[model samples]
Target: MTLDSETFRALVTEASLSPSVHNTQPTRWRLGPDGRVQVLEDESRRLPVGDPEGRDLNVSHGSAVEGFCLAAGRRGLVVDVGHDGVHVAELTVRLGGVSDPLAAFLTQRRTYRGKFEGGAVAHAAMARFEQSEDLIVAQDPDHVAELARLYDEAGLRWFRNVPYRAELVSWMRLSRRHPSWSLDGLNAEAMEMSGIEATGAGLVLRPGVFETLDRIGLAGALVAEAAVVRSASAVALFHRPANEAPFDTGRRFHRVWLSFTQAGLSAAPMAVLADDTKARESLQADFGIGGERRLITAFRLGVAPARDLAAKPRLGLDALIV
Candidate 1:
């Protein structure tokens, strides 16, 4: 059956809430003439430098697709998604859907980027994560510190790439004065950066200033996230079957994150660990990731201080539906 206009709007709005690289929100929805919904990619939002292979981009869309499906389930509707090898998917919706338990945490999930509270992660929580076949938790202080160093090395390596740095900064909403601060991309507040820190980031990420800082050996320390990573109660490595498509991987990615939220844990993705070949290989070898598994990503997991943060910035329905 065709989705009513109100239902369509509601579903698309919830779907848009799914996270994306740089918060680009590249997934677009179309109420096709045949009543099925068409999921399309907005090529203009592609992160050519940061995600040259489009793996992350595809993953972003996949998460949106899962979001849409979950939203439908919440309304007692089912979405049968049909996807070939292409980037697009057609969703067939109907009644008689069971709501997903993880859907309860969707609205509560945030990419917590700030420092986590100090303390050992609860044994129960750590045990739950450890029990998951797809996850490996590193709670050893030495191992976490080592991972932090490797993360910094990988981050600094990427920071030196001119185009990559430029592409990242372009999506950064460093000031509340920036026009798109509330619309899309990474805003300073969500990043947990103070005004001065935000301003400094804009300057530090500039090629010339970064070069000078690196020459003096200050850039590495400046860009380092070791403190943040080391503060985590534990780090998790997310892995999947080696040949699984990223779209499928992304579906599970969102679910796993929502599970973290349900367990009273906050997390932030450490993409550098999975994106850098050396870092990825190191993690796979050290973590005992079997040959049949692909290391998808990593996360720093911990309990965050209670605070009422601003709502996530997202484009309105008009911008998402075409």
Candidate 2:
């Protein structure tokens, strides 16, 4: 490590908070030579069923890189970032460039999967979230309701698939007794799982619950749909041409997330829209997107309730740095 231990740990702490599929926390950090921070992908942390194509992983790495830059900017440092490949990103820190106004919120951002107190989101509040021209956000009530239904419809296919259910069951660390309980995977609190559901899950969750909850996916599937509809105040969707780079979109997404954080509003990423092909097409068509653009990401924007905490787990600083 070229940087001092304290500086390195601070960078890793902020960077690791970047959200990943199933809270997998797939990106790791190390202080490289010449004052650069190296971001490495932990391929072992990839979710086979949820992100087999690694699109989620690629976007996740992008978010982490943005996070590190934001963290540095908070301390009056400007960082130049580069994505070398799908797995490797390098950041060279300098002392120039204007700091982000919301840079202080790099650590306070959380993904709220629960219901939001619904109302009209101020247009001014949302306008700042459009970091780039690529973002397509819908804040009206009718449009948001329709998007919710589409999310529900798209998830049905994944619900019946044995492998997908098995993979979800594997990540359901519903009990503290589970070995990965403190390190990674979704916990009972994060999922906002009801008592009965959590009990049933804790009783039978294993590497693959193909025999247990695999049959119970119908209920789980409905809950997933309801959560999106119930919680969102607005929906932000993004698209890019097939030949263009999608990584910058992730960077823009994180800035919007941090802006919401500074405003006391919370949001949740809805990757299911991009994960299912039918869902993605429906989204593009419904939104009147053109120019051979593909839906790369979508999220529900709303004000989260008070006292809720982030439930996704992460490895220790030492564990994250190699």
Candidate 3:
């Protein structure tokens, strides 16, 4: 369990792969004087406008911790993990343990942003999730279209809300030329934008552009995003009532993500749906969800692309460790 500085650095790098809101990479770490690795939620990285409830931040932290645990297990270590303070988690890795079979997926998983080819999700891919009461999959084109409509409406709401769009825009790194492009947050390349279209898209992200689109009622929902939603083989929603077992919810949610990745299907978050309260409520009603259950996250799944995706830059472990 003894970790030199370099080993500790490697561990944290692998752990930080868990997705965050806008790729904020909101978690930080510190190699304690006592040898345990302390995982803390970076207060500065909190997205108050985008995630007012802080549930999304906490869920993302849980997912990051899970990734760290999987990596530890893969290295033959038994990990003791727990929360020490608000948004603070502690990890102690001891030698001797069987590796997690899902460990490989920790690196393989990332939100797929490309448009999906046609066809419904295979029946076999879903059979594995039958027992998960909280997961709902929508494969019918009509159902997906309804979800897309909801997604676009949600985007409109975001555009109109100054605080929301401003907060999102700040995190967007327009191109590789931007200094922060590889360090953190959303980089344009990950969206597959290229050439003149890439530069044009960046310009529209400027202030007033979104506002003008909102005022004109242009179909300003991201074209590629809409295409992805419409072409998705299936859309998945994970639901649970508020104030429930939040950590377990995240763990199960991350597991679902990895499971689908292993099965060769890619999952992308329909984050806009959860950010707008009206769209969130309407989605619940449209799907006839019970009164007690509320959707926590929405995603679309499709076949993985033939090539590997470029790695999104993260604030590496050294920088992550406070």
Candidate 4:
């Protein structure tokens, strides 16, 4: 049966909340006459510099598809997703679906970019993650410190790339004055940055200014996240089978993150560790990751301070539906 406009709007709205690379929200939804929902990638929103291969972009779309499925399940609707060339996926919706346990965490999940409170994750939480075949947790303080250093190094390496830096700044809504501040991209408040800090970031990230700082050996220390990474109760490594498609990997990615939410913990992805070639290789070797597995991403797990942070900026439903 065809989904009415109201039901379609609700499903797409929930799906749009899924995380995307640089908050690009690149997926577009189209409802067909036959009632199948088509997921399409908005090529204009792609991160050409940061994600040249579109790997992360595909993953983002995958997560959105999963989000749509979960939203459907919550309403007692089932979605059968299938590969549809020229589109990300074609979803056939039907009734009689069971609600997903993870759906409850969808609205609660946020990327806690601020410093986590001082404490360890609950013992039960740690145990649950340890039992997962796709997760590896590093809790030792010393090991965490080492990983933090590597993460900073990898991040700094990317920061030195002019185009990459520019692309990042383009997606950063550093001030409330930005026209799209509350509509899309990474707004300052959502990043846990104060106005002063956001202003400072805008200046420091300028290519010439950053280069000058780097020449003086100040850039590394200025942008380093060692302290934040060290503050995490544990670092989690998320992996998938080597030959698996990123779309499939992304489906699991959202589930893994929601699992963190279910356990009453907060997390922020340390994507640099998985994105940088050298860093990825180092982590695989150091952590005994089998050759058959690919490290998709990493997250810093901990407790965030209690506060009502601002909502994540997103494009409206009009822009999402084509």
Candidate 5:
């Protein structure tokens, strides 16, 4: 059965809402004959310096594809997804009779990076989160500690280099003033910084604090130690057996993220941890992802509490659409 054009359009729009590295919505959409939806990577939207290897882009596109699949599935549709690289994925939807209540989450889900409520996540919910073969969720305090070390190591290594630092600054949208970097780059507000503070401080690390912060920012479990702290209730690290042509990482990310969204969780990625080879290897060593199957994305999951965090805006659909 064929889906109406309006229904297909809404699904694509919902899919595009998926988060990316610094909110870089890198996926492109093309609707084909007989209800085929093509989700391609727009290389132009890639973070060349920050994510030179394109790992973040893959995960971002994966999130989009995942959202698309969920949206389609909710409407009694079966989706077959294919990917060529971190940037491109193709999803073909054929109308099916299956019903998915979680389909409603496609529009409701948001990348919430704030203080999560106290108490352990329900085991049943966590079990559902672990169901994805492409992803692994870390629940133990030991696991969080090990993962924090990897994240700190990666941040220190990457942020120290002048080039990567400059690349990061380039993406920092400094104000309610500048606009070119809209919807994509890091919004100062999301960094736990207020508008006035962010504008004055810019992206430069303060001279002395850089050393301490380089080790671990406020995001890790360390800074929030005393508070009723929670990282992603279930931290999912997406990986592939061996990097396939282009879509290996993207395909893996999409399938896993979609599964999480299907299970009623607010997911947010911590790219600072995922970009480093050493960090990935350390995580692999701890998690035992051997051989060529490398880590492609790291996502944290939990119920988001009401807090005032930065909400990065997106360009209108017209701007993203070809």
Candidate 6:
């Protein structure tokens, strides 16, 4: 199959569905006159304040590239991918090999932030999962209890900050009347709680809901953590050297993240433990991480439970295409 404008566009459309840090779709793509796809950083989409450097941006790029690779495979194009910078990865796709069976799972994969079926993610599978150098999975219930506390503490610290809260509110897409907001921020429907039908509104912590969320957030994090620990499967934590640029590390982090998704195991990045310094330092001590290596992202993997809420919508190709 030859690379043409329409085919390339279709490939990119499929690729954009991949997950990223904060759901920030930071990767930018351009097609050279020579017919190759060129990807670069759209610094505007970057979370400079929260991410400081472009670490998260890079990881987002990696995730995007992984999506592209999967899309290419589905289209019967074999891809050669590699990094050009903290902000970029160059990809060349050509006709080749059998399509990956997991390629179909890309668009279907979602960051299921609800309950997981109680069970263990087989030891053999867990062992294979640990093979990624930058990843870790915690599936012990006691560990889940500890991790839940960590996630709660992190959320408490994050939501308490006026600027952070403001940023979160800004990204929220509250209603169908305003469609763009859906592109980013946490969707209310995605949160697991009672008395609320899964609605794709912005993270609606209505007045009294804060206390409930406080409990649910803590419990959900614990449940997620325990799911990983109990099923002997929780999530994969990715990291690279601390001195590396944000963009550089992020690219690598997402590559591993999406690979897990393509494997039929659903995952979502959890940077709470990584972003919380005191927590990260303690984790370093516990996980035996040393020598200036730092955590980049973590993902919880498990079977998604069915719910009434609809899947979060994505911006149409026409709007996202540039």
**Taking the tens digit of each residue's C-alpha lDDT, what string does model 3 give over 1-322?**
5656776777778878877778888778888777788888788888898888787787778777788778878877777877766546788877886787788898888777777755445445756665668878887789988898888777866766778778887887776888888888888776566757667766665678766765676536543366668878888877877657656566667777888888778888887786678988888887777779878888888875577567777886666888
The regions of model 1 sitting more than 4 angstroms off are 84-87, 120-123
TM-scores, each model vs. reference: 0.97, 0.85, 0.91, 0.98, 0.75, 0.78
lDDT of 4 by residue, 67-146 (tens): 99999999999999998687889999998889999998888889988888865454457678987899999988898899
RMSD of each: 1.3, 3.4, 2.3, 1.1, 4.7, 4.7
The better candidate by TM-score, 1 or 3, is: 1
lDDT of 6 by residue, 15-121 (tens): 88876666767777776666667777667777766777666666677777777887888877888775665427667767884577667766676777655564454
Report the C-alpha lDDT of model 1 over 1-322, residue by residue, as the tens digit: 7788789999998888888888999999989667788889999999988898899998898899998988899999999989865637888999999999988777888998888886655435777888899999999889999999999999999999899989999999999999999999999998889999999999899879999999999999988889999988889999999998888888988889888988889999998899998999999999999889988889999999988888899999989999
Alpha-carbon local distance difference test for all models: 0.89, 0.73, 0.76, 0.90, 0.64, 0.63
- Candidate that would win on lDDT: 4
lDDT of 4 at 240: 94
Q: For candidate 1, which ten residues in a row score worst on lDDT?
A: 118-127
Kindly give the number of clashing pairs for every candidate.
0, 0, 1, 0, 5, 18
Model 3, which residues run further than 4 Å from truth?
Answer: 1-6, 119-123, 219-224, 245-248
Mark the regions of model 4 whose C-alpha exceeds 4 Å error after superposition: 120-123
Output the lDDT of residue 303, model 2: 75
Residue 86 miss distance in model 3 (angstroms): 5.4
Clashes of 3: 1
Summing lDDT over every window of 10 consecutive residues in candidate 5, give the lowest-scoring window.
220-229
lDDT value for model 2: 0.73
Using lDDT as the yardstick, the better of models 1 and 6 is: 1
